[model samples]
Target: MQSRGRYHRTVLLVLVRTVWIAVCAAVLVVSGIAWSTVSTISNGVERSFAIPEDAPRSSSGRNILIMGLTTRLDLHGEPLPDDVLRRMQAGESDRGGYNANTLILLHIPASGPAIAMSVPRDNLVPLSSGGEGKIKEAYGRAKVAEEERLQAAGQHDKRTLERAGREAGRRAQVQTVATFLNQPIDHLVEISLIGFFHIAEGLGGVDVCLKNATKDPLSGADFPAGRQHLDAGQSLSFVRQRHGLPNGDLDRTKRQQAFLSAVARRLKGADVSAMQAMIDMAKQDVVLDSRFDLADFARNVPTEVRFETLPVEGGARVDGLDVNKVDPEKVRKKVTELAKEPPPPPSNDGIPCID
Candidate 1:
């Protein structure tokens, strides 16, 4: 009887040892899976862009140009209005020339909420020509120059127009705008109304609060006073409406900033399902400049970043059109102060190209 009891005890001890081994193996498997998941995400983000080997590493600081283009093509093959299409085809609109709807310069310091300053399309600046014109006209002038060059080269009308459009799109517009910003722009990202709307919808929606009831017939936006959740279309109209606002473009600029802030806030709190939706939306809606690495940048966006508009008094009529302009000297001084870095002594340094 004693021998049988001892044998039973030994078997129980063996069973416990076997269970311990199985638990350790299960833990190892789970740990391996977790490590693999993290590594895969990191690699996917890093490989999204072909960054230059010699590109300056971000010094805990970043500066980006956020341009809102005025194009009307939808990501999912929807067509724009016939008149809008005609304007684009005729090179009279949607070409990023005299009709650039929105221009914003965003500066992200090594630490802080990003500062965005709008350059009134009407601010007069020295053009490549000795004469001066509205800031909005600079790109148009460049487009005209490219067209002239193509004509001089004896290109056919259609070919000349195409080449001119490409050249105009690739020129130094961003850099010129950067000069107006009074600092070097480290990166640039352009988004259209359609793209913005798609992104907002993909994230479910964004909340916007207005102090008073507002309506804009042209933009098709109507909002009652108080907090409300805006869908994709409403959000677009909210940011794009200029008329009826007390301050016009200035007020619109503030609204744009607010919208972007809300979007960023939503993204920060997004769950896995929301992130997947965003990724899918980007695959369809985004057409980035070749230099942008969206995945990497998306993953690295700082949570503590703040958002503010550039200092500007208001809007005024320039050259028969209402436009916004930045005081060059004032902008320079403000940027220097905000950067907390002394401005370099005045020199006639030429502007850099947007590579």
Candidate 2:
């Protein structure tokens, strides 16, 4: 996603989700003076996909699902160039196989606190049908099965098949997560890995702090423990590094949240033109369903938007794969508490920086 590199690892597809909302808020702030920029981003806001017509919506708010996928396929379902593929690390895996590496459900209410609930990638959950599997695999499996079914039914165009297949996969993913959490998923935003890198670059870089020096070849993360600015590649590495951290992916989740807060700080001070450029660059990487207007919705959004992990019980093995386990009741309890929370504290910023 950061221009100057050989394309070789898709894991760097660190799609920082919270920034999208923050940037929307920023753009809205600059809309009066930056009409041209606002107009440009608004033009690309065309509805490109469908959500359930009968999807449940709360009178108080809506639940938006944001998914970070592992595949490098573009919106239309075609594979990207090898160099792009390699940089995104999509080349590490076969095409057409997409995993929801990051699954976050953001609850925006008309009143009270907003919740950014994160569902662990390796959580064990029931598939859309029956039986259990790593929740992340739901999309990939459904996509593959759908593609096969469509192919047999005589749909032969590669692009057409891929598109249809991905849609099935996305629906299954949304339904599965919604059912598991007992929440209605009202909308979605999908980000490609390459898009993630460019997005960070456009926004400048996120400020991050580490508790200790760390390095990881798998994710290509190397940093000294302290406060430092992270460019696109480094930002990707910071949130993408899982192996070296004490809590593994759980830690990376924090990195993601911290990055979002950093984004909020960055956007808060950016000039209109800078913010506009960031939005323009980001538009190239993000895919949305139903063209939800963040600026319009931002009006009713709770002043307190905070991120929290879905309460997890512990780790458990499902079908031989390690997974996070959660009690449904506990999750509901947390959601309830989140809904009643007061204005979010400034500490909404991520992991503490070690001086």
Candidate 3:
């Protein structure tokens, strides 16, 4: 009983953390408010030039890359305030690097339902940095290299260097995923670990259902089986715990997908005022491509979205690191098949039961 409970809790955390970026986008696109209002709120939101200007876009639909970084630092690469850090329990800023731990490719066509597909972080593939490695490493590797190159060229300003390094990281990550999936990236949304925490807080709390009652001390998750509401901190814990899960990280990934579906359902029912308030709280933590127009994107979005995890052949070790082995051709084919299907009907009631 304890073992199964842990597995469900782990899955919940993984799903929730990975899909925070999608939820952020949903807030912008589903707020059901005036474009001018969205534009006003987004006035000073950070923008990235990761996607190239001349990149070919899908004439049929839009593909958005939602990435979650492992870093605990603020977007500016500075340590978070002590109080905020304490609230997050994310530890000091030095703990994590810029690895893109969560990657979800969301495809929204000119018609039909939107599809949000989660890419496992440990997938071994050819990277934009020139050699093959885990897909998640593309960001940090490029960032470090760019920072070094800049320092060699006599740049000493910490903020300037940090910004430049991160830009390089973003470019590498975008290119890597695009090439892997054989899809053009129409937009990019990047958020850090703290972004996840802020998003959960902004939502007030999220409704989640677990199949088994569980206790995970590491994640501070202790909840009974069945449907329930989790506050910001508890929500984070529910999505972060993988230690006691039966399938470990894989279960967590499944949870992330389920969590996203639940969030989308919640957003669909939210009033414009509530969504606007959440967007205001989240804008600081989000980094969208400069070309992205929230108003325009929101106009075409369908109320229904389906979430899935791309199929992986299995796992193997490369350079002593565990990685998911995936066939690129197979992945592309799967995506094509999914894009052709009609979307499922929107649901507003029961939480997505996860275990």
Best by lDDT: 3
Select the stronger candidate by lDDT from 2 and 3: 3
The TM-score-based order of candidates, best leading, equals: 3, 2, 1
Give the Cα lDDT of each candidate. Answer: 0.50, 0.66, 0.73
How does model 1 fare in lDDT? 0.50
lDDT of candidate 3 over 124-213, digit per residue (tens)? 999998989999999999999999999999998999999999999999999999999999999888878776676666556678888888
Q: Write the per-residue lDDT of candidate 2 for residues 50-112, one digit (tens) a residue.
A: 477777765657888888777666666666767654554324435525888888888877666
* Candidate 1: tens digits of C-alpha lDDT, residues 1-355: 6554333323222211111111111111111122333333333321112123354434536655555555564322245566644422322224333334566655555543444456555566665433666665655567567767777888757654644543364244554665666565556544445556655665677777777788888676788877788877787778777777777766776676566655654654555555555544444444334455433443333323333445665566765876555577887777666555423322422211110
Question: Which pairs, if any, clash in model 2?
Answer: 7-86, 7-87, 8-86, 8-87, 9-86, 9-88, 9-89, 10-88, 10-89
The alpha-carbon deviation from the true structure for residue 285 of candidate 2, after best TM-score superposition, in angstroms, is 1.8
Best by TM-score: 3
Q: Candidate 1, which segments miss by more than 4 Å at Cα?
A: 1-60, 74-98, 111-113, 127-133, 140-148, 151-167, 268-277, 280-300, 341-355
Model 2 TM-score relative to the real fold: 0.83
Candidate 1: clashing pairs of residues? 113-306, 114-306, 120-324
TM-score of 1: 0.65
